[model samples]
Target: MNEAIALMKRHRSIRRYKSEAIPLEHVRLAVEAGQAASTSSAIQSYCVIHVTDGLKRKKLAELTGPQEQVRRAGAFFVVCGDTRRHRLLCAREGRAYEARMEAFLLAVIDATLFAQNMALALESQGYGVCYIGGLRSQLFEVERVLTPPEGVYPLFGMCAGVADESPMERPRLGAEAVLFENKYPDDESMLGMIEAYDERYARYIERREGAGRGWSGSMTKKFAEARRVDVGEYYRSKGADFS
Candidate 1:
């Protein structure tokens, strides 16, 4: 295998970390690596804010709910999908700024790519990392704390530091389940594979994370809730005018 693929295969969602400070040079280099990721149409519509203040980090921990990793990690970053700056640029150039769903999606895609690239870069350098999706749970609180403009909002938060524990590689469904030649696989075949994966993943979680819930079980429990907790209105409030 090529060195890059081998490095990628070693990825783990690290939560626990050593309590040492990360060097400023390493943090700066990681951000540079994030910028190296592919961007949609060269728009590069993303921004990353490193959270260094102890009080702010603690508040962020509250915003994230039970994910204490944000408060404990050596470094934390708030990655954002940003189009406000681009809109200002357009205004300065006497052009109309695009503010549709397509534009919003592109910015969010760029932000995710940047964040994943940063994770890969940090992992390659022996740093452990964990992504905090809980930041979206209380979008308005996050918005208030970050003070993002009308066209910008926090996508997710990330924490990185030296490893305190080694996690096992999780299992994935084989190519038969996910990969297809030309057309999508038959429904029966897909369902069978997914069912098999659920059982396997359940065992994996029980063995690894001590969580008995498997993939489908875990997913079902989350989705079976009668009410949805997503912040669609909040996104709309952030100037997203979707079709």
Candidate 2:
């Protein structure tokens, strides 16, 4: 494999980290790399907040599953989807900023792409990184803490620092299950692939976590109930339209 592909394959979601601080210059370079990521219609609808306040970080950690990484990591960032600039542009022309689901989707996709690029850049610098999706646990509290305008939505948090642990790479489904020739495979074929994956996943979990759980069992229980049902309402409050 090429150097880039090898680097990509070595990705691990690092949680524990050493206390060494990442230089501010490195952080800026990472952001620059993130800005280089592709955007839809050239609408750079994203903003990143570097949270350095000790008190704010403590509160955010509490809100987001008390994930201590937020408070203790060498650096922490909150990636947001922003449409405020577009709204102001419409106002400049005395036109209404009509909210559409498509626009909202574009902002979300753009922000996600930017974040992944930023994470990859940080990882390339030898800093371990972890994405904190638990930030969605309390979107309202996050808004109160960040105090972003109506058009900016905090999507997730990220922590980057020197690695303190080396974790085994998690197993994923094989190409035969995920890739297809022309048409989607039948349910029977998909189930067979998933069953095979479950066996491997169970073995991995037993080795790493001493748990016998498999992907299907965990996913089935997780989706058995509607989760984060209020996320849509939170977006609506930010003037995002679902219709």
Candidate 3:
């Protein structure tokens, strides 16, 4: 495989970061590379917020699952699914538009593309990166801090910096379990593949965490819990009109 393929294969989320700071110029270039990411219909319905304040980072860490990575990373960014610019353009041109589910999905797709591109770009620059999904865990606090408008929502955030350590890549399910041909195989066939995968994942987790709960056990526990997140409602309240 080529360099890009090799790099992607070795991808790992890094939470432990060194204290060294990344130059602002490089940060801007990485963001520009993110901007180059494929946008849904070229709408570019996304935005990024770079936060450098120490106190604010601490506050974000507290609100976002108290993740130390947010506070400790050399550079932090919040990627937002935005429709504000589109709304403004529509209003200026006397065009009719409503923030529906489709619009929301497009915004999310655009933002996700940008974030992934940014991650790759930063990694290519020799920076370790991690995406903080915890931003969604506490919506109100994140909204308060970001102060986004009605046509914008914080999708996720990223932390990038020099790495303190190198970690092993996590294992993934085999092609048989995930990648189906034109037609999906029978349930039993898939289950058989997953059974094999479970054994591999169990060993992986055991080696990594010293406790091997395996795939089914870990996923069962994760899904068994009531994760009552009002994501759709929150977005609706913030100008994501599905009607």
Best by TM-score: 2
Model 1 lDDT tens row, 14-122:
9998998789999888888999999988999999989998988888899888678899998999998899888899899999876688988998899999999998888
> Lowest summed lDDT over 10 consecutive residues: which window, candidate 1?
226-235
- Which tens-of-lDDT digit does each residue in 9-49 have in candidate 2? 99999999898989999999999999999999899999999
- Provide the clash count, candidate 3: 0
Give per-residue CA lDDT, model 3, range 1-243, as digits (tens): 999998888789999999999999989999999999888779999999998888778888888898999999999999999999989988899997665888988999999999999999999999999999888888877778878898998888899999997988888999667877799999889888888989999899889999887788888888998673777677877888876
**What's the lDDT for all of these models?**
0.87, 0.92, 0.88
Pairing residues by index, what is the TM-score of model 1?
Answer: 0.94
What local lDDT score does residue 120 receive in model 2, on the 0 to 100 scale?
92
In model 1, the runs with Cα more than 4 Å from the true position are: 209-211, 226-230
User: Model 3 segments beyond 4 Å from truth?
Assistant: none
Candidate rank order under TM-score? 2, 3, 1
Q: In angstroms, give how far residue 18 of model 2 lies from its true place.
A: 0.9
Q: Is candidate 1 or candidate 3 better by TM-score?
A: 3
**Among all candidates shown, the one with the greatest lDDT:** 2
Worst 10 residues of 2 by lDDT: 227-236
RMSD of candidates 1 onward, in order = 1.7, 0.9, 1.4
